[model samples]
Structure formats: structure tokens, C-alpha cells
Target: MKHEFTVTSILEDARKKHDALMVLVEQNASVPFLYMDRDENIRDVLYHLYGWHQILSDLMTKNPIPPIELRPGYTWKNLTELNYKIKKEAESYTLHEVKHLFNQSHNHWMSKIAQLFDHTLNAAGLYPFTAPSNLGEFIHECMGGHYQWAIQTIEFHLGDPYLRPLLEGFKSLPEVEAIVLGGSRGKQQGDHLSDYDIYVYATKPIDVEERRRIIGPHVSLMEYNHQFFETEDDGVLNNGIGIEFIYRNLDDFKAMMERLFNGQVNRGYSTCFLDNLLTTKIIYDKKRAYKSLQDTYRFIDKAALYQQVIRQNIPLLYGTQPNYFDQIVKAVKRQDIIAVNHRLTEYFSLFFDTLFAINQINHPGEKRMLEKALSLPKQPKELEKTVGKVFDNITSGDFLKDLEQLTLDLIKLTK
Candidate 1:
């Protein structure tokens, strides 16, 4: 029988447990850090985790590079063990000491990735580790997805008050036309709103560079672009920047909202969180802000549905939530076999379903490529056999014997 689970439910449970854990950590006498696992310390390790995962995943299919051997003494364990290893290898220090470490590690990995783009390496390397040519398009997926997870986990456990102020600051910007709070918390379904995911619509199309200056140093801007209203036959609107800016004024904004309400207007494809909601916040009139807020809520409800479809179809690219695979490894280390088994099943099911959905959605020309990349066989029975083999491997305890084994298996399979 197939197991059933909803992302919303998992997020909600994680939030509740995280909140409870935070309270315990605060009131307890011995624990020095707010989080039991010292998650902050592990940021560097997390970066490396992402790097290795991305590299190994590419190696498995595209380039087939020799697999890197896992270091000795590392083994599968519970979340605590993973955190301990991260902390142990990490330079000793308090929260203050590690604040810069995250950035340093991030830059280090980025630099390494940059090297893959060098002209000499581009042609010779087995697989380039850098992001795609359209970096702007992909960066949001990386930052938004990961940060959403990090913020949720941190807010649940750390209780940071800074989140609200950060959001309020964004809201205060005059240029922002609509702001959508995406994620598990947007619908108030018990998912923790850790990081603020704000979608700021400007009245005028600002140049990417200009938008950067406007957003300034406080917050890092991910992706910004001018969107054109278009039609299938007439083609995209070719209005100049000045005209586009003029069209974004209060009157045009109201007209746009009215069209949206009457089902006469539609926005382009967006992978953002707000797509799941049914409606969105509209700021047509400055005096009637409350009405705009109501509309915004409905718009978001509609958008949420869209988000669900995207997740269902897309390859598992990024997640901020504690790496479920890593968590399983940690559980094994702590000798929590039951917990490891349960989580492993949950994660395996999610991945399988996600990949299967991607296969179903494959475009005509891309079907063969995807099928080959995913190792799907031509025959239905063959596909079942392959899936069964994967399940058996997951059930086997050989990978759980040590960190090295676990990492190797994960790198091989997840890739």
C-alpha cells in the first residue's frame, strides 16, 4: 500500500515541534545555544552539502566523473550526530564567531563554482558545476527555496523578532504595489513563517541596476525583470520603459485589478509561493488599503494551487528544511533505527512521487532525454523493477553502517 503525506502537514508538525523545542532550550539551565543542534554553526557544512550534492548529481548522469570517496569515521546517524560533526569540524566559537563563517563558506563555494566557468575548464571539465547561463532565472529558486526552509526552521526554534521588522520595512516602500507572503504560513495553516517572502510589484518598470539601488544594502535582491502584457497573435507589448512606468500609476493599477477581478486579465507564469493562493493583495487605492489586503488574500489562495502543481512537476531542486536525507543519517548515528526507517520511507516516497510527476509532465521532445536521465526503462514492468530495487536498497542497513557509506549511497542514488 502507498503511504500518504501532505507537505502542509509536515511543515505544520515541524513548526509545532520547533516551537516546543525553543521553549525547552530557553528554560533549560545547561544548554548554552538556543537550538539544540547548533544549526547556525553548520551553515558551512550545509553549503558543502549542497555543493557535493549538486556536483555528484551532475556526475551521475551528464559527465560520469569518478565518485569522491567519503572520509573515514563519518557515518549515518541522527540529526544530532550530523550537527555534532558540523560543529566539530567547524571552528570553535559562539554564535558571534560563526556569523561570518556562513558568508565565508558561501563565497568559497561560489568561487569554486566560478572556476568551473573558466574558459579552459568549460570545454575540458567532465561537468561544469556553475549555474546555468540564465543565472538570474535560477538564483531565486536557490535563494527563495532554501531561505524559506531556513527561516521556517529558525523561527520555530529561535523566535527571531527581526522577521516582522524586516517585512514592515519592505511594506513601507512606496514603490511596492503588491506583496505576497508565500510558504506554509501564508494560509495560516500552522506552518511557521520564518523568513519573509515578499513579492514587490512596482508601479514602474525599474531597470535591474536601478532596482538594486532602490532595494539597497539591507536586503539582497534575487531576480528582477520587466514583465510585458501579451497576447498570442498580437505578440508582447513593446512599450518603452517610460510608457510602461506611466502605465503603472494609480489609475492603471486600479484598471488592472478590475480586469483581474472580471477575469479579463492574466499574469505570466511565476514559480513564486503566492501562485497557490486564490487571490492576491491589491493596493488600487491608497485610502482603501484594507480592501486591497482582502483581495491580496484571495489572490494568494489561488496562487497556492499553482505552487502545488509546480512542486509536483519539477525535479527536487532545493529545500531549506533540514535535509531529510541528512536527518536520516543522523538518526542512524544516534541508533534511532525506528526514526531512521520512518523518515527514510517518508523522504523516499516524496522523491519518488516528485520524479514520477516530472516524468508524466515531460514535453514531447524532452521525453526521451528525461527517461534516459531518470533511468526509466521502456517497459512498465522494467520501471516497476527499477523502483523496487531502489526500495530494497533504502531498506537495507548497509548504508546506515557509517557516514561514509551513507553519503556514498545518497550521492549515488539522489544524484
Candidate 2:
């Protein structure tokens, strides 16, 4: 019988395959299985499968799954490293614990995939920028192909320990009110170059020496007090993972959040801190103060915030005589690349702040912005192309025209 490939079919097949795999796992689970020509066992195979499920689950939670585009952070060439990390992370768990985790992740994947519409499942280019394959094919590869591969490999043969110490050390500090894991990893949208952004909120200064004493042993390279935009201890962990220990004054941060929430707007880079606060994962909370603050500001006045951002930034773009456009025009005339770059930066900053507010999302930080903007449901027509044109013509006479066209296109979204 020819097999059908619908959601129901996928689910049924996945369940049957999972049951078969589990049974086989039970039968020869104790017999060491060489996985991928590595010194790995049956437990390693289960954890490896579980890790993929977890990745898919995270992607599903974020709507319109960004192209798996080579499994989030690692490319095809370096996938072995990702796999190695997955295996290392699961090393500490007992066989029983690993089984439990595997089951949890597998069930979670099924639940999230089931929530999708049939059209979305079969639709092509749903994630166009990277992997143009339809969701159904992707699902089958992860679920069906991977499970089949695991079964065949077991016929022949078959895990991130770092989080614990960091949490424990930070939790011990009396001055630390909350420890948050931010950046791309926290958002689950990390690429290969992403790092661990540990935002440490404290009541008082954490002496540089004290921080070093806690975090130094785990990291091979450490730099204390690099004050570029924030005071942070930047270093690379022994495992070659980059980490930044960003310190923030809890009370001051709270106050700033209040102002942003209450309609205050900056000329540029507005809502960035708000974005950071909302997106970060709470690693440690001394007295739940951080949690309370998050709860309090979690739901903002969207319409009000949207209007405030638009009202504050729209005029700065082009509503006034000699606006940002005019300024950039004059700069380009004088061949002032620096001034042109500066105004362009301010222009795009406010442009993005307005765009994100209109879409009802907090402004995610500075990088991968165009990618993020393109993902938003509400955006100007040909956003990527237009933005690209502006940059392409930055030093030419066409610069102002591109900028004006871009600004006008964006402005129309407001109405």
C-alpha cells in the first residue's frame, strides 16, 4: 500500500516508529551501539534524537519557523560540532533520565506540529530565505527519516554541562538580584556566531575580583570591566563559547523600563532595553524581584506605545524642513561619508523602532534586523530590496531618492 503523507499520517507513523524504536532500544539497549562511527552508546542515540526534537519544538513555538537553514547555529560543515555539543550536554543524565527527556521532547514536537494548518504543512517556501522546502518534507526528515536512520544505525550499532556552575555562582552573590540569559540563544534564534549574554542585575557593584573568582575557573580567557555601552566582563569559556557578563543596576533598570512603558521615547534606539527585558530567560532570581518587575511590565500598552513611537519619530524622518533626509542629502553633497553614515544610522534606528512598534513587537537589538523586519507580518512592500538599494546608493546622488522612497514606503504602513 502506498503511504499517505498527511498530518494524521505523519503523527501515526511517528508514533509507530517511536514505539518500534523504543522496543528495539529496550532489546539491545545495554549492548553498546557505535553511533556515526563514534564511541557512543544507545543512550547517546536517544539523546541525539531528543536534541533534534527540542530544536524543532523551539522553532515551532516561534511562528513562521525561520528556515532551519542548517539547524539554527551550525552549518552543514560544522554539524558534527553541534552533535558533539548535544551529546556532551546529555552526558550527565542517567539512562532513565535520558529516556524521560527523549519522550518529553518527542511528545512536545508532536503537539506543536499538530497545531499547524494543513496548508501551512504542505505549503512551499514557507521559510523562503534559507530552506525553501515545505514544512511537511522538513517534518518527515526530522521525524521519519531521522527515526529510520536511528533504527538502521542501531541494527548496526549507537551531551552542555556548563549551565549549572554559572547559575550556582551567580545565585550565591548577595548583590545579584537576578541573572538573565539573553541574546540569540535566549531567543532560540541563534546562529553559529552567537554567544551567551548573561545579564546580571544587582543592587550594588559586583567587584571585578569577585566576579573573576566566580567565573574565572570555567573560562580560559577573561577581561574585566570593558565599558563600551555597558560594563561587562567579556571572555571565552574553556569550551570556546563566547560569554559576556553584563551588569545592570536593578533599580535604575526598573526606572528606565517605567519611563519607556509610560510613553517616554528616545530619538533613536528606543525600546531596545524593553526588548532585552522581555526576551531574556530568568536564570536566577534572589527574591523574585526580577520576576515581579517582568510581570508588571510584561504587557505594555501597544496602541499607545505604537503611537508614541510613531509620533515621536515620524517627524524626525521627513516631516520637518531639513529633516533626516535633507540632512543626509546635504552630507552626501559635501562628500561627508561620516556625517552621511551618522544620519543614516539615526534614520534607520528610528525607522526600525517605528516599524517594530507598528508590528507590536519590541525592537530586537541591532543585528539581523533586516531579517527580523522581513519576518514581521506588517512591513513595507519589497522591504529588503528597498533597504538594500538605500545602502547600495549611500555615497551616490541616488542616495536621497532611495532614502526618501524608503521613508515614504515605511510611512504608509503607519496609516
Candidate 3:
């Protein structure tokens, strides 16, 4: 609601930023890249202004109001990625060609912006699916915002020349909505031999074959059934650092979260998702929506969370014996590896649920569960040793006894 800038104000701000960017171009001879490589910073600022302008013109006639959040057949979600695409496309041309296209794009954008009515520009809920906003705000967001950021980024890169290469490498990747750094590297908890756990968030799910193509020559894909990145492009090795590629669809994630928040979580299918959402680090958030999601789930209804956990997990844990926990013990006595392991995972889920319920904490995820649990308010006795014991000695004769003791310990703690 606060972003209702008039077209005149929009043009003025854009003109100012555009003027500043050109000064850099003029001073640097439009060769901002090292040794005058691709059209560096200014190239993007101009090209994206052109794109926003072009998309707005097209939006006037699309059937059913095309999702303004996205453009057709292309994956440019916001100014950040749109600029990247434009810059890449501009690479073929010399600085002169690049400037020519930019001028054309800029004029095209200005012509449309000049025709917007105040009523259309300032109205709320201009589009149904998006936030309450109008054309003026959208133009300001995509056009002006890109310029403002580009200048800052350009200045920062000038100070730290090393960063531009890394940024460029990241930009080279295709259809990247966001790139999040997670795991030990993300949380800054790694010692040595820590692989880069990079989560690639996209507008759509990239296929296994297409994903393998854009990968940098430095990193090799991890083997299927690899330790960290199990199957389906579990890893890439860059600069001798193991890099894992975790591709997720932002659209799918939002839909899943909507279903879960609306009481669909009783099925217990998305426990891992909740964990990842909380634990992962957002390194590159283009639309800046992920943080809002984290905030939404940051504090949850403990009683309700417990209810979901108990309803879904109790029966599975307490299969046929006096209780699910007891039933697990019997399965262990029968030496059913498959059942024991399956039930063990279910117990982990239930145990995680129980811990979250007792402490009223959001689930951080399945990784480092016992360590994460111990750091919480009240911890069960021998929790650390028992958790390791469960996995290590699942087939051990004392597995059932250990399970019983831990279950009883949980009862005592919650009470």
C-alpha cells in the first residue's frame, strides 16, 4: 500500500538512477567487465526496464489476466532474474549494440508509462492473485528497484572485485528462482570437509537431465545413494568442495504449505518440509518471500501440533501390543529389520513430535535431531546415547529394552 508512486514520480526516480548508471558507463567506456567482457552492470539495468515495460503492455490484453508474478515461457520472477537473463542475452553484442538495444527498450517502457491513468496507477487490488497494488507500484518495483539495486551492487563489486566472478557464476545457472545455502555451510557450523549444501529454488521443477547440463565443470555429480545427496543429483564438486544441488519448486512449496496450514498436516507427511523451512539459510531470495514463510511458521500452536503428531503417529508406533512403543519392542524381538527400521523412523517422527510438543519449539528438521533436542528446554535422560543406540543397535537384543526405557523417559519428561 505504501508504494503508490505516480508515473511522473516513477519516471523522475528512474531518470535519476538511469543518469547515475550512465555516468558509470561514460566513465568506464561501457566496459564495466574485467578486460571489457560482457555488458556488465548498466546493461542489465536498461534491459530489465525494457522488459517490465514490455510485459505491462502485453498485460493489457492477456486472457484471464496472466499471472503478473511470472511471464510466459520464461522463468524471470522478479527484477533480479530478469536482469540476469537480459545481461546474458546482451553478451553477444558489443557495448554499442548493447546500448542501442537498451535505448530502444527504455523508450518503449517510457511510452507505456506515460499513458497510465492515475485511477489505474493508484487503485488497490489491481490484480486479483497478487498483493493489493496497481501499475505504478509494479513499475516502480520492477523498473526503479532494479536500478537502485544495480548501482549499489556495482559499487560493492568495485570494492570487492572477487565477488563479481562468483556472482557471475551463479547467474550462469538457468531458471534459478533462488539459491539457498544450507546444512553446516549455511548455518556456519562446518569444521572441515564440509560440502556446500546449495538449495536451488525455481519457478518450476527442473528435470534430472536438464539439471545435469548447466553444471559447472568444477563439480562432479554425486553418486546415486551418495551419503549426503541421496539420488537424483545429490551433489556437485566445485573448487574441490562437494556441492549438493537441492532443486525445489517455490509454487509447489507454497501449495504444500497452504494445505498444511489449513489442517492437512494431520497426515504427518510434511514434517521434513517444516524442518527444512526452519533450518535452511536463504542466501538468494529474489522476491523475498521465503523469510515471510519462516516467520509464519516460526511460532506454532503447540497444543495443535501435538494433536497432529499424536493422532498420526500414536497408532503407527503402538501397532498391536499394549502401546505402539511396546509393539515396537515386540517387532524388535521378532528381528524384523524392515519393520523395526520403518517403525524406528516413525518413532523418530513421534519422538520429534513429543519433543516439539513438550518444549513448544518449531521443528528445526530431522538432521541432528538428538543434538537439536538436547539444546531445547527439557531433555530426556540418556537421550544422546539412546538416539545413537537406536540406529546403531537396531538389531541388538537390547534394542527393545533401550526403546522401552527411552519411551518411559519421554513420559516422565512430558509429565
* Best model number under lDDT: 2
Across 1-415, the per-residue lDDT of candidate 3 in tens digits comes to 2666787888888778877876775676543532111123555545555555566555645523445445545533344445446667655666666667666766667677788776777776675423455667767765667667656545532422332344445545556666655666555455568776666777666655555555544455454323353323555455456666666777787787777766676433335566667666655566666766765665454366655654555555544445567656767789898888877777777777666656755565566667778888777788888777778878675656676677767766655
What is candidate 3's TM-score against the reference? Answer: 0.51
C-alpha positional error of residue 128 in candidate 2 after TM-score superposition, expressed in Å: 26
How much lDDT does each candidate structure score?
A: 0.37, 0.76, 0.61
Q: Model 2: per-residue lDDT, tens digit, 1-415?
A: 3223578877877888888888988988676432122215677777888888766655555544333434667655456568768888778887788889888878877887687777777766664422556677678777867888778656643213565576578889888888877888766577668888889998899998999889988998989999998999999888888989999999999899878767677766777888788767676777878777765666444568767888888898897976788888888899898998898898888888889988878889889998899899888776788678778867786746666887898899899
lDDT comparing candidate 3 with the true structure = 0.61
Point out where model 2 deviates above 4 Å. Answer: 1-9, 16-159
Candidate 2: TM-score?
0.67
- On lDDT, who's better, 1 or 2? 2
Candidate 3 worst ten-residue window by lDDT = 31-40
RMSD of 1: 24.2
Backbone clash pairs for candidate 3 read 219-237, 317-324, 318-323, 318-324
By lDDT: ranked, best first: 2, 3, 1
